[model samples]
Target: MDFKVFTIIATIVNFLILLAFLKHFLFEKVSNAIDERSNNIKNTIDKTNSDREEAKNLKIQVEENLANSKLQGKNIVEDYKGRAEKLFQDIKKEASNEAELIMERAKKDVEREKEKAEEELKKKVVDLAVILSSKALEKDINEKEHRRLIEDFITKVGM
Candidate 1:
């Protein structure tokens, strides 16, 4: 190759002009596009983290609601059990009172029947006594006189 001073200087000047043009037009636009893409990626990551945290909080709230529902169900069952026990006790007390009334009525009926039987026996004894006295005093009395004497004796004995 021929070593020419003027040609070397001209080539260096052309290369410097091309570098300045590329820096002003192509490089500047490319660098701005790359920075915009990096910013978009960072915003998407932050949004994804926020959505994941919201989902975790929702899951915790649902679990707490489930536990509260279970406790309410248990309380309802206990209330029903207590009401059933109270109803059973009331029925038992009513049955006991009815049985006592029946026993008292039975006792009154027995007492009335005993008194009626004693009165019937006393009337029979009175008739027997009158017959025996008439037989013992037979010879001393006429028919009309005997009847009047028996009436008088019965009146005195009744009093």
Candidate 2:
């Protein structure tokens, strides 16, 4: 063979041997490493997506709970308002009842006072009439005649 041909053939044989050796020893291990790294990346991305979804669900649940709590608070406030109104009405009723009772008692007291005043007035009038009759008769009678006349007047008035 020519020297150039022999050198080229030798170079080609060397390259083929190197390729076979790399295929047998290095390719599988390197490819397996790359595949493992890719799988790890995919798993990490999937876990991140699932975590995000879980966080969103938790936020929604929290919002729902807050809304329910607000509704409950509103209900409690309304209940309190109704109770307060009822209490106010009850107080008004009680006050009115007390006022009526007081007015009735005052009226009874006034009626009793009027009756007592009328009796006192009747007694004064009777006394005044007796005094006036004595003055009117004083000038017209001697003592014995006054006694005799008074007995006659008394009998006629009694009859």
Candidate 3:
């Protein structure tokens, strides 16, 4: 094993020069590319996070709008129900008033009819009394004859 010191020194110097050349040209460009790629990946991740947050906010807004629509629908239904109930009550009251008016008219008609019948009855009684008086004057006012006249007058009045 012959150790040559000058040759070893020359090889070390050559290795150092090759390392410096690679670091200045190839290594510098490769490092720049790696840094650019890392920055692009970080920007993409940030954009994705922002998009996800925006989607979540939009979903919340949609849910709130849907809830509001449902509440409005319920309110509309209740309002219509109230209107219908009021209309029904008004109609019922009007019908009751009409019925009362009809009953009053019927009562008045019945009263008028009863009064007319009573007037007719009084006139008939007066005519019968006059006939009895004339017959009594033509005959005598005896008890048996008077009783017979009353019986005939009663039978005629009944018929």
- Return the TM-score for each candidate structure: 0.58, 0.64, 0.58
The list of candidate 1 runs beyond 4 A from truth reads 1-36, 120-159
RMSD of 2: 7.5
Ranking by lDDT: 3, 2, 1
Model 1 over residues 37-99: C-alpha lDDT tens digits?
A: 989999999999999999999999999999999999999999999999999999999999999
Winning model by lDDT: 3
Clashing pairs in 1: none
Worst 10 residues of 1 by lDDT: 138-147
Q: Mark the regions of model 2 whose C-alpha exceeds 4 Å error after superposition.
A: 1-17, 20-25, 126-159
Error of 2 at 140 (Å): 18
* lDDT tens per residue, model 2, 20-107: 9998899989999999999999999999999999999999999999999999999999999999999999999999999999999999
The alpha-carbon RMSD values of the candidates against the true structure, listed in the order shown, are 6.4, 7.5, 8.3
Question: What TM-score would candidate 1 get against the native?
Answer: 0.58
